[model samples]
Each structure stands twice: as C-alpha cells, then as structure tokens.
Target: MHAPGIWGIIVVAIVVILLFGRGKIAGLMGEVASGIKSFQKGMRDEENKPAAQIDASTTVEPVAQPEKKDA
Candidate 1:
C-alpha cells in the first residue's frame, strides 16, 4: 500500500490531539526528547573512556598454602 500523504498525516495528528489533550501530548514529547538526549550523552561518555582501567589497590594477590604432613 502507498504511504499516507500530508493531509492524511495532518488528520491523524488532529485525531490524536483530540483523543489525548494537548498537555499529555506535550509531556510525552518532552519525555521522548529527554530520553534521546540522555542516550546521546551516554554514547559520548562511552567513546571518551578507556576500554579497561583497573586500579592497583583493587587487584588481589594469590595467597601461599601450607604443605600437609604425611600420616
């Protein structure tokens, strides 16, 4: 089927606005915008950081075990 033209899109938009008040639509749009912004920020942060950066203090050394006596 062919895609809806400008008039069809406009009619759909009007119907949606009528069903859900302007305030609710505006709030949803705001939330969507914020989510997109947050995603972009996370992507940028991931790009800047190193793949692996372990601290020396956090590393654990293996402990020595005592030998068992024969029966």
Candidate 2:
C-alpha cells in the first residue's frame, strides 16, 4: 500500500518509452554511457599518476605576503 510495486513502475517506463520512441532513448543511453566511460578513464589516469605530480599540480602559493609589524 505504501510503496508502488515493480510492475507498476515498469508499466510507466514502457508507456514513456513508447511515447518517446526507441531510437531517441537508445541514443540518450549511448551518450550517458560514453560520458561515464570517459569520467572513469579520467579517474583511473589520475590514480595512476605519480604522487609528486599530483602534489605539484594541486599546489597553491600565497598570492601576497603580509609585511611584518614593528614591535
């Protein structure tokens, strides 16, 4: 009663797909998969990089040094 069953969800999905047509849905899924693969590849390449390289790339220096105040 509280939760909708799986069959009801599947029926709704089928109706939406029928309205949108299969080709459009397939193309969208292909793009999504390509994006995910590229993201994963980037992550793996980062992981495989040397620690020194990562540290150097992410280093930030202070833009302005404060003057010492007179005692």
Candidate 3:
C-alpha cells in the first residue's frame, strides 16, 4: 500500500537523523547552501565579465625552432 511506502521513508529518515543527529545535519545543510551560493556568485561574476577581457592577453607567440643534428 502507499502507506507502507510512506512509513518506510519515514523510518529511513528517522534512522538517518538518529545516526547523524540534528546539529550535524543542520551544519551539513548549511555548508551545502553556502557552497551553492558561492558557486552561483562565481557564475554570475563570470557572466558579467566581458569575454574579450577574460582572454585579452592570452595569445601564444610562436617560438623559434633550432635545426636538429644527426649523430
């Protein structure tokens, strides 16, 4: 029945909470949220930066090659 599935989920959740404790769970969630926010901010900053500016001085100059001598 649907009730059994719900109960099973509830039991699993309770077991997980008991194993980790409330404070640990909250701290983990807080850290996850902070990470997500930082990632979003980085993405926004990247979008706001001009693409040309990002790679403005990234040209690779060709290097001179020396002739190889056979032994």
Best by lDDT: 1
| Whole-model lDDT per candidate | 0.96, 0.91, 0.93
Query: Which stretches of model 1 miss by more than 4 angstroms?
Result: 1-7, 53-71
Q: Tens-digit lDDT track for model 3 on 1-71?
A: 44568889999999999999999999999999999999999999999997664576788899999999999
Error (Å) of candidate 3 at residue 7 is 1.1
Instruction: Determine the backbone clash count of candidate 3.
Output: 0
lDDT of 2: 0.91
> What TM-score, computed on C-alpha atoms, does each candidate reach?
0.60, 0.57, 0.66
Candidate 1: tens digits of C-alpha lDDT, residues 8-51: 99999999999998999999999999999999999999999989
Ranking by lDDT: 1, 3, 2
Clashing pairs in 2: none
Model 3 error, position 65 (Å): 19
Cα TM-score of candidate 1: 0.60
How far in Å is the alpha carbon of 37 misplaced in model 1?
0.6
lDDT of 3: 0.93
